[model samples]
Target: MGVKAWLSKPLAAYVHKKQQHWIQHPVEAQKAIFDKIIRKAAGTKFGREHHFDKIKTHADFVKAVPVRDYEGLASYFELVQQGVKDVLWPGKPIYLAKTSGTTSGAKYIPITKDSIPNHINGAKNALLAYIHETGNAGFLDGKLIFLSGSPELEEVGGIPTGRLSGIVNHHVPGYLRTNQMPSYETNCIEDWEVKLDQIIEETIDENMTLISGIPPWVQMYFDKLIRQTGKPIKDIFPNYSLFVYGGVNFEPYRKRLRESMGRCIPSIETFPASEGFFAYQNEQQDKSLLLLLDTGIFYEFIPVDEYFNENPTRLTIGEVQIGVNYALIISSNAGLWAYSIGDTIRFTSIKPYKILVSGRIKHFISAFGEHVIGEEVEQAMDRTMAKYQSAELIEFTVAPYVSQDQGQSYHEWLVEFSRPPHDLGDFEKDLNMQMQQINTYYNDLITGNVLQNLKISVLPMGTFRSYMKSQGKLGGQNKVPRLSNDRQLADGLLAITSS
Candidate 1:
């Protein structure tokens, strides 16, 4: 074994011991974090506004601070941008993670010195957990690639600002620097397609062992590798053993990814976001993520059904139940208090606190009150495609198709297939039936005549990619919404195919 892998074994053990303490004492861990952050921020502007010092319990917290999305915190963010100190947190943030996709456009999320360790260590511990479990630190000896955004930073309020992935790139450990791939110049290329080509050239013959990225962008890399070398990814990089991914469910892309790799390999799923690093799949066998209770953040959940209500019930970690969809809220070291990050999740196990990201609060389809979520659509598609082994899926999305002249409105599926199915009608029937089986409300809508059966619209190959590129969202954490309540995305897809 190489020095790094040999050294990781002991470090992994120590990290695992720490992880076990929090897992066994989840509530206490969260309570400690809650008290620390609240006490520390009590003197800040937001702390004074919400009377954080006066609050002593979760109930008091709910009563004192209301949950808000990025837009709701705009005024405080503006003050911070104007170089105000102690407005949201104790002082100015060391950096701001700039992201897009919110209705208000770009959001500048603070990352304080106290909070930076959570983002960095969350990822570090995840890998260490793997090493501790399987004794597979051999990946440390080979090249590791992270297909990420440009690390270039611009100024926001005199603080360095960039994409979260880019910001994390700056913090890559000194030890791992030699194993990281695609030299700095290639990573900074402005266009994703151009950057991808350069990455292919740089790592095509390297001893790659680990690959990390959002699934779609990684798929693009795999595709380019196959075209360039005319070999399966496994054959191209025989040492590749670990795949780490986040931002979307992996089930829909699992089959294609496995096909590209020529075999299944161990994988890890993480629940990291610009707001906080919340969870990671700690076990090789268990797909669910263990919520990081000891991280410098406290979590709250509001039932999805009650999310839009005037006053919703907010539950602490101890109050959450398995299988119930909840809009995730967090109070983190980054100075975000009672902040709704717009994502929804469900607990799979409460014994040690495991969760699956169910969907986004704003990214659901309730156009006809059916209330379908991202998880359901992804699962339905997964099941349907599993039966059609010969066909290959590229990308897909669903939106409600409202008829203008009083005809029945229905759900429309726009899918891009790299390898078309033998029988398109049968494929559509299976997909519709799968949706009906997974979502009773969608089934009811069709059966009750409120909506017709869902229709499949086979988009030409590359249509989705073209549309995303046109919108300047072709890569780096941008994903096509799996479920949209309206027809805007659908119309955009159709326009691209037609043009």
Candidate 2:
């Protein structure tokens, strides 16, 4: 029997067992997880200050700790960087995941020993869940490649530091290492262009059955692979049946990826931030991802409209409703106490709790009362790209032009296209029309003539590439922010293109 098949029976059973248990007691499952985490970290400085020892119930926990963004929690993190123990978690963190940033600068997020399993097992269970539903375990037998950051870690205040994916790469189970592709040495190369070339050369002929990464980079790798082999991805790896992706909205990339592969593969999406692995597509046939309730993280939601208010109403898992855009707050075993991870998600299903990421909390465009959001931008891009079959949107960012210069305000889009539309003006009009369909506030402004039509600049190719390089976030889970609340990100990209 193959290694994957031999290992599947037990893993599949465990996944099914957990699924059944979670299904029967969805709310209680999270409550139990919350209690366990609170008790585990009760000895820490944050725990002591927040009275974690007394926090027996959800109401008490909420009363003890206040809602905080990254900035609010920075003080504790600063101490932890100096190798402080028992500050947030019970002891020192095993590793710190350094995240890519634009507005906030590079943020170092801790990964405690207690939280390590939550990060690793959460992904393991996701794959097990996929196998359980699809009855496909051969994926485990062949090589699985993770297109991640350089695995060479650095030290910060005596704590190991690197990208989250790179951290995970160092910890891939001993059993899976034999089936994993690309040598450890190659994975440590920092330059993406150099690393991608090596990765293509190494895996071009391997028996790779699964590939996982952020969609854009994965697409880029596949494009390069096809160019090298003179064949589509499916042709190159006939056994490739699973493609795992996340980090950015898959809607816009879905069309492009499907075209690149020349066929569809079963793919799963995940909400994996540096704070915690929050959710994954547990069901094979559904679009909504099941929240990882049993993971070592306590989940909370605040309605997006109320998120910035002085005293916004915060809702526990039991209180969240379907279809409301919510900014997610998490308290984890990793030492984050009631921390806002800056991502927004909406519940797509109430039973068993499945959600769709609406956007980043900081990534929005609301200059002229339009309240445009990430979800709208994704859907609009999807629709427009679908309309013009020949057009390909490589990457893009949008900003509001709240200008009194032309006697009107507008939203300006900077787009990088792989294949330019036959008529750029027509493409822009279609994109604007699609945007109006999804965002009523934006449409109303246009209809009232209070705002001019959306202005689009067809960026010279490599515009986003240059910007990401300049910001030192060239690849590996970094993406261009889709909607900038201000013009900083868009303006930065414009500067890159102009230079």
Candidate 3:
């Protein structure tokens, strides 16, 4: 083995040991890491005057650094765009993970060497959970197929830029690296169509043991595979063992995927973003368990009302309460102090701190004049699916549509189904009924003349993939956004709602 390869395993082992030790003794871990980071930040002028001055205790660190959205990261983004150093961090970042923001066109997030370990550890924890759950470590020994974005670092105004998938690809261990279908950097083609076709062709004849990527892209590829081969995915490659994905909820996509695969493939959910990989599903897989990476970030949460406004009370991991939804606030090693990524989550438990992703704070329908959070939508959908003999949803998107005349507003849903419901009208009615039943407030808004209507439209088979592809958004990190709040974006999507 080469020097780097020889050194990697031992280095990984050492880091893994430290992680286990820290997990067992979190109090000591927090104090040591917190003091070190404080000292490091305090030693610098900007850190002392701007950062350290705001933080008195861990609690103060949570509160004083006001929760900020992507727009709040604009100044840091401007510095990176200009190729200036130390705008957010102390030194030049090793790489930047490019992702599309909801309102801010495209976001370029810097990741330093110190921050990379968080992603690595998060992935390791996922694998460990798989091992513990399945009792099969060797299940992951074969070639793994990662349906990731192209590794080509495009120059955004003369600075190197690549997607989060590409950056993570570049850092994978060499042993597994050689076994990957697409080599990092070379596999990601700039052309979206060509890349999809190439990815489909590559996986056709391979004995892919493990598959990983966003659900929509995976569904898209499989849809193409079925069409091309005239056979189901199980017949195409029966050797598949695991499905690893993140960037969106898998619950909506699970039923259809299970039917497509012909059986259950041990699926794993990872909570990752351009900023950092925050959490992963532990062995039980009841909910995503937050594996606190104290070395990389100090985390906090802020509760939001059904109206989508942020509440004043902020809670740390130590202070998080069970069964309450809170928007995530993060202060990371890369120098984002008290930043809100806009994603909301609810804790399933507190002793070990298991969390379920609620939805994005910005992706809800309030302009329609009725408050609808992700939880309410998810519960309603779950109940609807349950009534319809377990018909699984492949992908779906929700938006509020207003009539041109002055009248009550209505919600229009575009959903893709894996298995056709026995009765389409019945399925639609059941879904709308469940929506009213689950959230009485929403029902009151609808019945008491607050909102005019609610409508659910079933899209033609394969319409979701075509829509995503047309937008240049078909692949690993991109998702079929659950709620499209912007009127323009919503109208554009509605235009192709598939009659």
Best by TM-score: 1
Model 1 lDDT per residue over 83-183, tens place: 79999998899989988845888889999999999999999999999999999999999999998898999998899999999899999999999999889
Total clashes in model 2, counting residue pairs 3 or more apart in sequence or in different chains: 0
Ranking according to TM-score, highest score first: 1, 2, 3
C-alpha RMSD values across all candidates = 1.0, 1.6, 3.8
The runs of at least 3 residues in candidate 3 whose Cα sits more than 4 Å from the true structure, single-residue gaps closed, are 1-21, 24-32, 43-54, 59-64, 155-159, 183-186, 306-311, 390-392, 403-407, 418-420, 497-499
- For all candidates, the clash counts are 0, 0, 1
On lDDT, the candidate that comes out on top is 1
Give me the displacement of residue 322 in model 2, in angstroms: 0.8
Better of 2 and 3 by lDDT: 2
lDDT of 2 by residue, 275-334 (tens): 889889987778889887777788889999998898788899889889999999999889
Comparing 2 and 3 by TM-score, which wins? 2
Candidate 1 clashes between residue pairs 3 or more apart in a chain or in different chains = none
